[model samples]
Target chain A: MPAEPPVLEPQFATAEQQRSASVLGMWVFLATEVLLFGGIITAFLATRVFYPHEFERAAGRLNVLIGGINTVVLLASGLGMALAVHAAQKGQRWATLTWLGLTALLGLGFLGLKGYEYFADWRDGLVPRTDGFDPGDVTPGRLTLFMLFYFVLTGLHAVHLSVGLGLVSWLAVRVMRGELPRAGATVAEVVGLYWHFVDVVWIILLPVLYLSGHHEAADLHF
Target chain B: MTERTVSPVATVLTFAALVVLSLTTVGLSFLRMGPAGHLAVGLSIGALKAGLVALVFMHLVRSPGRTWLAAGLGLAWLSILVVLTLSDYLTRHVLPS
Candidate 1:
């Protein structure tokens, strides 16, 4: 059976035109997202410049092993998403759904690891602005500032990942109903863009948040 | 939009590179790099990984000029924010008291 062409919206003269518009809109939205996270990152960097030792010490307390594993997990998920988009473009519905399912699972795995890491942080008394908060050897004030940045950055990232997970799962449902790879390829492509962007954010976060300090402890436990 | 397809080979290669780069960043942290050294190395590796993701995984290379413009504009604005903010913060102690 021949693939059905996407329904052209009344405002757009051609299907091609409408698809481009949708993609462009998504990219523009992603650009604004860049600035939103970028602003917080800038503030973190400036604060680090002021008290490098405190920040590094604080970062050292973070669980690098978890962060490192999540980086690879997210990267693998990105591969799944890229493959899903490729399959969708070829009009392979089953392939698209399979890849999408795997992608969402990997995303869930990332969040799971992140949640475990957070729990470990709580056990370690690293959560800032709490009665049980422990600054260790670092100054309490600067360490609290660093912890605030950590929680804010990672918390926002988890929120974005959760959103991406919802989008991917929705695409999977559409693919199952045969609504995708025929008329919904653009939608898949757009969600793929969002998923990869989230992975990119995590990639950037890994180094900034987890790897900027000396790791004297060689144990990967917790 | 043109339906450009990335080969699975290329996609896998990008993923491998990203994983390798991630490990490299972590490994570098074990060294006794001073604060600036650690930040520079970590962020440099990070910037490289981000570039790969943007160009390959994000499909920026195959995207049209308008899309490129949007990505570029985002980077430009981010640069302005970082440069301006750091200038003041990094230079406050430059003048002899």
Candidate 2:
């Protein structure tokens, strides 16, 4: 007697139907995520319109070098994730594991760099609402507002990145255990899409966070 | 597992372009553009890089209509919110005339 083939659910008559539905579901979820981040950004932009100079000055005080490096790191992680998706589709288990592992490592590298920058900012008195927060030629209140936006935006992004790291790590383990490929490529594809969307958010955040006030670094440390 | 679809070489190239664009945005920021102009340039570059990543790395370019519709609807909703909110805020007088 031959082993039984994997059973498809009644709702999804074909494997392709199941895969399309899964992908569509993930996209819908990501769309919601866009609005979640979008609301914060909209608030920031409104604040910017009112306090352009203060915002720019406060922006300059951030560590652009570290931020820039983190951008590269995240982009690298995206590349690894894209490759992992390709490998998963090809049914190369070991290759999928390798790429996913690399993606997670890069994600960790991003978080590490981001953590270091945050610590440096805190020590430098850059945190809004904290004492000794001084940005030259800009009112403390305005500067504080800018810092508030900065922290909130980047903090939210960090949270998302941490989640991506966990997801990628989980995917790697599953691939190692020979679980995912058997389940079909939908899981890998949707996971890849989520990872890339995170990367896109950072790509937008990089400029809004780092570049907006970078030109006028009146008192930058680095 | 299934057959490979996206080309690895193309993905790598897209990554390279994104990195280069990032560096360029940083470098451009060092020059004096007014606040609005600076933001415009930086964001435009960022958007371009994002387009590459989305279309290539995310496989949106080859995705089915269902996926595209989902993604488009999200972006459209976001745009509506941003534009309308900004319009109202930008037009209001924050100070006494």
Candidate 3:
């Protein structure tokens, strides 16, 4: 009789099963991440509903140019991360590291742009304290609250981006040493999950912050 | 032997979808819809774009159905949290006046 492989030996299984397990596990982890981002979104929604005019007025003053450029920058960084994964899968280690480094640079550019935006916000009296802002036609309490949410949510996102950059940097080192794990796509797969989630947050932010001003300030919302 | 191919075509398609969704949402903003319309359009386009990213680039659709199950359940739980918590917050200041 021919020898049979043991049941516990995953090496004997087809690639399809391995890929499926990785996907499922990654999804479960993503679910948890969704909740994290979801909380911030919920808070944003709640506050925005109660203070529509205040949010509209405050959001109108924001520089769409910065927001728009950051959006493109983030999207490109995400693309680079995706390509790095593809290169790693194809066993092009140098190509993978190069893409990773590009992604890191993009990420840094994003943070740098975001930093300038924040500084502008601070200088323009957009801070949350009742005394932090100038005399505009907004409810002082509500306007301050909107700025608070802006800082907390976007600031938290920046923190996550910083961590993501660090993760990619480490992955870049792995690629350099030719030690990119044979576990194949899981690392790229997981980081991609995080990257997409971050992008998703910005997707919501774009409308609420940048586009909210397009309509009348009194427009009722929830 | 197993093979791993870099799917430039699929990635390009996803990028196209992202761009389209972004444009669609922005165009919708110009329409004078009340708050409901704004919310509906923004969220709808956002959902579609996020779905594209998840499915094509993240390979959610290419993976096993179990992955969807895991993700869907989490989203469901999250919605419940949002609903219940918002219900409490909304009603807290109401009915007492």
Candidate 1: residue A62 Cα off by (Å): 0.5
- Higher-scoring candidate on lDDT, 2 or 3: 2
**TM-scores computed on chain B for all candidates:** 0.92, 0.88, 0.74
1 against 2, candidate with superior DockQ: 1
Q: Give the number of the best model, judged by DockQ.
A: 1
DockQ of 3: 0.42
Q: Report the Cα lDDT for residue A212, model 2.
A: 88
Q: Which regions of candidate 2 fall more than 4 Å away from where they truly are?
A: A1-7, A216-222, B1-4, B93-97
CAPRI level of candidate 1: medium
**lDDT per model vs. reference:** 0.87, 0.83, 0.72
Structural RMSD, model 1? 1.7
Candidates, ranked, DockQ: 1, 2, 3
Q: What is the number of backbone collisions in each predicted candidate, taken in the order shown?
A: 0, 0, 0
Compared with the true structure, model 1 gives a TM-score of 0.95
Tens-digit lDDT string for candidate 3 (A11-39): 63665566556656767877887888788
Deviation in Å, model 2, residue A173 alpha carbon: 1.9
| Candidate 3 stretches greater than 4 Å from native | A1-23, A215-222, B1-6, B23-36, B86-97
